[model samples]
Target: MSSLSPTSPPPAQSHALLSYPSPSILLVTLNRPLAMNALPFQAHWDLSELWSWFDDSPTLLVAILTGAGSAFCAGQDLKEVQANRLQPPSQPYLKGRPPSGFGGMSQRKGRKPIIAAVNGVAFGGGFEMCLNCDIVIASPRAQFALPEARRGLYASAGGLPRLVHGAGIQIASEIALTGRSISAEEGIRWLFVNRISKSQETLLEEAITLGREIARLSPDAVIATRGGLRDAHEMAGLEETWARTKERYEKKLYGAPNMLEGLAAFMGKREPKWVVSNL
Candidate 1:
């Protein structure tokens, strides 16, 4: 699932390799392995557009973000950072990551779900991307860290806040402030990783299986459910989050054909035939 030979079909856009492993699945492989998949600023904007396309695409319900080689991502290319320091970009948009943050994963509140399949090293912006994903399935060899502090930088791409939101302030402080690398098994303990794969060889397959499970559900239900879950983490006040979730998806979901189809499928004792989400 990771290899992208020159013989492979052209990438959907830039800075990554895209493949439709399944009708509902998008497998996005970060191909900059020589640099341990470290992404430059422009790469972030390219990825933002790619995710926007995925969110707007009716056919893609789930996305899997991985890397071509031994690193998920080492975060922003430090070489790029140093270059920017030496010779800053003349234009505003060229200076840093887009609003979607690093690789369009961190700070992303997209309509569909993204599953982080951490194959190897995930540091800095890489870890930030994992923090925001709905689910993270990691390889046994996978490693995560927020090493920005070691570089005299903090996780400005939204990792720190989301880390605290996910695993409490203590865990967040320990991970971010210490600049230590955590293993995939430890990630499970910290509640950052959903599961660890049997081995690195099987990581993508395991992720695909999980994504398919979600893809088989009512698309509208999935979107609404994801909205509710994200709201719990991103919004304040229980009652306010609850009310906002209802207001956001209720009317559309209640009237959607997928809603009716799901119930009918249950009553009839058959698998639901889902359509793309219009929610």
Candidate 2:
């Protein structure tokens, strides 16, 4: 069942809304509809801390990040930043802290998978956050862009690396250089978006359903699988990557309780009860 957090309440309704919509799924919503769910200073800090909470929570196995109202997110609150500073606020990256970038997930290194439910305009940091997700589901009306170039700024919140990694260097360069918004169809064509929903409401529903399905898997196996995939992506040599994948499977996934449970369940024609743990 869905439940909102009351003990660790967010700053304001305009900042964000955190809720547990299922047994193991966390739904994070950027709540500033009037501001297109822009990330103000407090919102940024809250998101940073919220990721930590999700990491520690044994109940939360998946996260669905989305925005309220018509827009997914319009990136930073420019008006709020302009009122206090001459330039955009500094990246939230600290010298020694958990690696959570803009909106708390961009540069984060963790096992839990996050799915971006892009309901509307996702510009600059918002687009960066979408890139940070393991999967992205966007509405037909949703648009994405790294418009920092147009504003004489740069995407410093893991946008460059994530974009280049997902969309290739050439497309990443063009998007960053032109600051042009990509339609949901174009995003799908470019392989940036996993799928496009008919509308925002359907987008969230699909994302939640997806998150629930993922949450049902063995948590430790999921963690190991995600880490192994990331390592393979970063490895240069094919032989070395294969060796590493084999080693990871043997050490982390193979012969584990979860693996045995799966085999037993299949043989017995029953559902497996997985023990959740992080390796």
Candidate 3:
């Protein structure tokens, strides 16, 4: 791993994104507010690259994805998409990228967790991005929708599947078919969002607190648990899932240093100092 630089050049302007480090968390913000932080062609590629960067950086235990200005993300920039001038790259940005998935949430699987801070409206692709996160904390004013059906397009980029997986078949179908928007409160009721805050600051604070809590746990354990859950969801029978989970515990997590620290801290009635070699 490389040393953390105090100063680093901003991500390419075409990318127009900002990455800041906070303790064990990486704060990723979409930076093109002029377009309502709408994702352009390059933005998708940049997001893919950013996810890879975070996966490689061991110090970054968690990521908080949010947008700058008023909108969490206004979905793909309509003008850019309609123009069709920007051809897809010869190679997919995420091809051969770490399995932590697209934008770190798609097909990728990683040890670290990601939290989405939906400070404002998340529509279409933006809403899908929120679904990709392990946890979502939304501001009270935030709204979510999948307007692709109304626009004569479909959110094929993990939106349909993730929504079904996260919010279940019925709710996902309603959102996709009707192209209706859901309030932050409704999002919580549907289990799409973990919590709703009164404002952005509170939402972000809650995200940071959750990230810190995750960071304090055994990294291996966290990864294994996440992987197990993901696999279990995909697998057929409970026995198979349990077997895989047992394998992970026996082969990886059991008796780890962090586990020892966790036990010692419990006995000593103090906070544990989690030590992870690979970060």
Candidate 4:
């Protein structure tokens, strides 16, 4: 697969940093460390495009999202919002908003898995992004919250629904209503976090390691598993659900090229050269 060289291009002003840290893993770091990586309007647009690029890029198999410096993200930029409101652009629709939802990944159906490496505070939209990720790795000092209610704002970026589904109705309600912060430990207890790193520096490391593990497997199998898990939640009837799951496996996994590669790799004691295919 092709890779991005260090000299390819400098970081875009709208982005903190976007780089390929590994062969198949892309690291998207929220760069505004000084302002806690707040998502200004431009940042949102950048994220929207970035997510689409990752989804279409054949070389990139997985991505790890994190924040620069100490904090993960402080949510939206209130100042930017206020300024935009004051300006009141003549063409409101042209103001550039992410169609994929806030931070690009929330409230949308995407195939590839994203891992949120939460290093510090993940508030408001930040927390919502964490909820949208396929996996979440948090630092011991990380804090998660949806403080929108306190500010007389609501979490409209799939935060409410994702939180409810990921953390349960009760816990989600408590977090949404109170607008208080929860520590990483509490997040683990609520099953929101997949793993806890000892420190902020290790958060991305852990996430990349996990992403690499996923990348090593058949991309088709990973996509199938992800799709099945997503579909499993909305399904009810046990027999029908099992049958559907089996059907997907038969169509997507069984007799697929990747399936043959996986079996051959195991038997031959060599890494399989897998191909990307929905079939």
lDDT by residue (15-130, candidate 2, tens digit) is 77877787778888889998898787666666877877776665567889998899989988878777546644356432222357777767877667889999999998899888
Model 2 error, position 55 (Å): 2.2
Q: What is the lDDT of residue 202 in candidate 3?
A: 81
| TM-score on alpha carbons, each prediction | 0.93, 0.86, 0.84, 0.89
Cα lDDT tens digits, model 3, 1-279, are: 123322334345464455554565778887878777777665666666666666666555678888888888878777865555466436554222234333435554555578899989899778877887788999988999999989898876677887787779999999999999899999998888999876767877788788878766666667777778777766778999999778766555667776777789999999777665332
Error of 1 at 259 (Å): 1.3
In candidate 4, which residue pairs get closer than 3 Å at backbone N, Cα or C atoms, i.e. clash?
A: none
Q: Residue 111 of model 3: what lDDT?
A: 52
- Cα error, residue 223 of model 4, in Å, equals 1.2
| Candidate closest to the true structure, highest lDDT | 1
Q: RMSD in angstroms, candidate 2? A: 4.0
**Could you say which candidate leads in TM-score?**
1
User: What TM-score does candidate 3 reach?
Assistant: 0.84
Worst 10 residues of 1 by lDDT: 1-10
Which 10 residues in a row give candidate 4 its minimum summed lDDT? 1-10
Q: After superposition, how far is residue 211 of candidate 2 from its true place, in Å?
A: 1.2
Output the lDDT of residue 133, model 2.
84
lDDT of all predictions: 0.88, 0.79, 0.72, 0.80
